[model samples]
Target: MSLTLSKKASEVKPSSTLAITAKANELKAKGIDVVGFGAGEPDFNTPDNINQAAIKAINEGFTKYTPASGIEELKKAVCKKFKEFNHIEYNTNQVVISNGGKHSLTNIFTAILNPLDEVIIPAPYWLSYPEIVRLSNGVPVFIKGGKEQGYKVSAKQIEEACTDKTKALVLNTPNNPTGMVYLREELEAIAEVVIRKDIYVVADEMYENLIYGDKEHVSIASLNDEIYKRTITCSGVAKSYAMTGWRIGYTGSSVEIAKLMGSVQSHQTSNPNSIAQKATVEALLGNQDTIATMKEEFNKRREYMYDRVCNMPLLHTLEPEGAFYQFIDVSEVLEKEYKGSKIQTTEKLGAILIEDFNVAVIPCADFGFENHIRLSYAISIEKIKKGLDRIEDFLNQLK
Candidate 1:
């Protein structure tokens, strides 16, 4: 007899963005000049102060297994960060540290979801949300957010989508793929819906510090007391501190939910890395100037990329207010052919761009958007210029 994987494992889709990045690397290995904009991680190195803290922890023999939830000191630091910046109060027990932001989210889903429960997700979402919900035996219901809506759904939309089966809502501000940051008023409107519907909210604010211009990130949990009880605010040091390899993420929620998540994590992975937890304490309580420096560079690249997209005749995109991606609308040229081969979908266009133009971008089809593609500005300014030039040249050739 042949062995088979579980039904859930067989149905889950692999990330299309990662696939394109792998192809890009393969071409580069063969000495091709490939300009890649496919990575979701920052290109910068971890700051020296953060690195030094981890080194100190290692040298001091602090590498043993910590508490399942996390070390008390690191949990306390997370509380302080929430209080100071997000204006949200939480005791140490209300926070749970996991291996990464993704792990924190998985723990929440496993704790909250039951069979056939529904989770409302806004479209043009991070590709992982639906799969994670499915893995927890929950159903994901999507509400589409097009360019007209600033890629943000309204409170009315959320209200209409909710039903008795709805158990949670996944809200991502400074959103992945679209880079849309919800304003204070918008968040207030959504909070009302969550309170009325009596559903949990998973607020992913991973790119909160990377916002540009006069824009600010407002955590929905900080808006009021009831919303605080209903929301799990997820963040980490990966994007802001350039510490993706460190693998530390944290969440703040009600004590009840936090305890349940801690319990779920205990059976799954035991604890996050001990050295990384110590480093995160310093990342939160130590010097924050590194964040400002990285934001400055991201802003420069954002402006340059936005201007280039604006000048291109057929390409269109919203000016990204936060995060480091430019989600471009490529429907205008999708119907055209390149050398008698039709490029009718973003996936086909993406593959051709990498194979012929030597440029790689993520197709947004898996992100629930068709005829659109996403490019990251986390790369160098010179590379951004070259990639944009190649994209424009490729569009010009579409017949």
Candidate 2:
């Protein structure tokens, strides 16, 4: 028989967001002035205090491997942060520190999912959610939340999708792509469903610190003791502290599940870099100022991008109350043509923008939305202005 790859590996969809970002980087490497709106990380540098912690660790020769899950000190720091900020209590044994938030999520799926088990995910989700779940041998079930609803799915929608095989529900507040934060009432309603169904809740709070205006971040687990017992909260320093390169992420869960995840990680990647773990300890305890600065900058960029996109002809967008993206409905231009090429979908539309106008945007087809696209305001305001100008010009050029 001919050699073949694993069915799961073969079936995984490539990340559309990364593909566009890679193309933009490739053009930039060739000295092209490509304005990019696809980056998911902050443009700011990692705070000096956190970097100094890593440097000190290296000087002290703290670079060796720690326990597979993570060092106890860092885990304890994470516990303290969770307890204080999230109002969720956690013992050190209930925490697992992984290489990054993405890795932490993969480990979680692997630990909790069995073959053909179902995970309920809302549409316009982060591109990796379904792929990660399917890679772990689980099935992904999606419920659509329309734009008028702020792309937030309801408890009734979640309840209707539940089945005997349902194992978990993936919830991301200040959600990716859409950038909408679920209100306390909205989360309580979802918590009620999770309680009634007795299914696990996988809460990705990676953007917890980047909320704008009066929108507050709430931990669903903090709603009650029963839900806290069943929730696995994943977060990292990547978004909040401009430490994406540090690769430190963690989960707070029940001790039993945390132990299993640690066991799985032991064979997968062994442990996160010891130096980075030490740096993260400083990130948690060292300072509170860097985060405020970054939030202020991000809020300014968010407002600028929001106003520009909203005023563009044929484009409609939701005001992102949190996170750094504007999800735009571009259905008006799908039926138009440019340079004799008919644009029938957001994928084709995105390709043309990158190829011709030197602008890069993430088409939301991979995000489970066919008529929309996502643009991140993580770049400088100058770049944001230039990119929006190019986008408007490109659309106007379309016939």
Each prediction's Cα lDDT score? 0.93, 0.94
After TM-score superposition, what is the CA distance of residue 275 in candidate 2 from its true location, in Å? Answer: 0.3
Residue 290, candidate 1: C-alpha displacement in angstroms: 1.5
Cα distance off (Å), candidate 2, residue 361: 0.4
Candidate 1: where is the Cα deviation over 4 Å? none
Name model 2 segments beyond 4 Å from true.
none
Per-residue C-alpha lDDT of model 2 across residues 1-399, encoded as one tens digit per residue: 898888878888877788898999999999999999899999999999999999999999998989999999999999999999999999999999999999999999999999999999999899899999999999999999898888999999999999999999999998998999999999999999999999999999999998999999999989998899889999999999999998999999999999999999999999999999999999999997988999999999999999888888889988998889999999988988888967989988888999888999999988888899999999999999999999999978988
lDDT, candidate 1, 184-272, per-residue tens = 99999999999999999999998988899899999999999999999999999899889898999999988998999999999999999
Q: How much does candidate 2 score in TM-score? A: 0.98
**How many Å off is the CA of 16 in candidate 1?**
1.0
